[model samples]
Target: MNPRNRNILIAAIVVIVVVVAGIIGVTSHKKSSANSKTVNIGIMTSTKQDDAIWKVVSKTAKDKYGITLKFTHFTDYTQPNKALQNGSIDLDAFQHYAFLNEWNQANKTDLVSIGDTMISPIHIYSSKYKDVKDIPDNATVAVPNDASNESRALYVLKSAGLIKLDVSGDALATPKDVTENPKHLVIKELDAAQTARALDSVAASVVNFNYATAAKLPENQSIYAEPINKDSAQWINLIAAKKSEKNNKIYKEVVKAYETAATKKAIKEQYPTGGELPAWGLKLK
Candidate 1:
């Protein structure tokens, strides 16, 4: 073969190799990108405040697991779980085990917890009285009316030594379950959101952490706080979804992204008053 013809043939082969290599590289890049997707999460938060912890977790999810966190807020407590069940959202982070069980029993939905989130300890707040023991007899004290929270509030009152419950074990105790009210205090049941507002009129009100925070109530002023323990284990917050999707890989990844050191730090920083505490195998300070 002539020298010019040999050189042309070599150049043509090089160009074809470069084109084939470019196509393969593009295809691989696209496939990797496809692994990344968005996950919609329903959150029932009282405050519209910017969530710093979620921001950190979301960044980690995107950078590491290729999942983007999209949060949808709801004012009503009953909405998130229902939304998750009906396929309106991918997952939800709100209710604790007790609350979830009550919801499941009532609605006949079998949503399962995917991972532990944080336990927002229930608190008894009083503007009029400095201590639980200071409240006068027959004084009105408000508590959340929802089945799960109402029972939890009653237990908190019992823990404060003001009341006694007739039931034991996992059975939720209500105001009627109060075998003894030494003070004969009037237990006024109100919506969880209204408990904070009723603080002015009532001797003391049992308020959820989120509702207390939303009302800008000082945490230090709380007369009594429910201790986190074996009894309160059911109150530990968690991420939940339809029971059928309990073992989904991407959902598991989302949980891993959230239950991290970074997210834990953010929770502490965001809730300096310790109203919210991480529940996933972390020691409480």
Candidate 2:
């Protein structure tokens, strides 16, 4: 109880208090850091079907992968790529190889595919006629205006025997490539997303799968549907990221999250009623 002993005891108590405070601060910081990291993904269209798939993927990412994945919805097929290029999103999942190649050439950006998603076949649907042969001569037909989709539309039309595309034209075929239009059909190029609406006005229109589903077209009942197979490799959909993030471990995991058999089931189930088919893409570990 003397003055020297009393001062020593007080100094010891102050040091203990400071040490305890430092420990608490460190523990709190660690907890905050462990919560997880956030990542944003860009997608073409937001639908209840996609929402279901996202719900499962988002929960799995947070619980098992320590990533908080958020999706930014876009109406235009062209928007997702631009968003990825400008760094507005961490990644995007709304394009195929042909479209990717065309965009890269057209825009001077270096986006690359991280993984594959699905192949939704493009088909020509006719609300006015029961068959392609029934289409009147000189009738107007609508096709997606985007270079990749336009070429696809042309292929479908050629397959119908209404026109003949020169062998050299192939996937790059344009309206001018038509060497013989037996029906003299008019090819009206419109935005890919608008082709379905154009069906009501044109004799027939080539519609992309997602847009067809969105427009509620009868794809299963369409007059002509593109066959799904290895031959359609160029139309296979993919998950894309900036060229710089191709090898990033975290982004790689995000890409793998969609490769699960369960995710594939969810994707296919989305179109149970019609308009789209799921292309379970490559499983890249």
Count of steric clashes across candidates, in order:
0, 0
RMSD of each: 5.1, 4.0
Native-to-model Cα distance after best TM-score fit, residue 198 in candidate 1, in Å: 1.4
Worst 10 residues of 2 by lDDT: 276-285
lDDT of 1 by residue, 40-134 (tens): 99997634323777888899899889898999999888899989999999999988999999888899999999999898888999998889999
Error of 1 at 20 (Å): 15
Best by TM-score: 1
**TM-scores of the candidates in the order shown:** 0.84, 0.80
Give the per-residue Cα lDDT of candidate 2 at 282. 40
lDDT of every predicted structure (CA atoms): 0.88, 0.80
Off by over 4 Å in 2: 1-35, 166-171, 218-221, 281-285
lDDT of 2 by residue, 1-285 (tens): 999999999999999999999999999999888665788999966778878887777777777788899889998877999999889999998888888988888899889998877777677789888888888999999999978888878877877778888747235668888899988788999988799988778888888877787788865438887765443767778889999989978788887777777777777788674344455544322
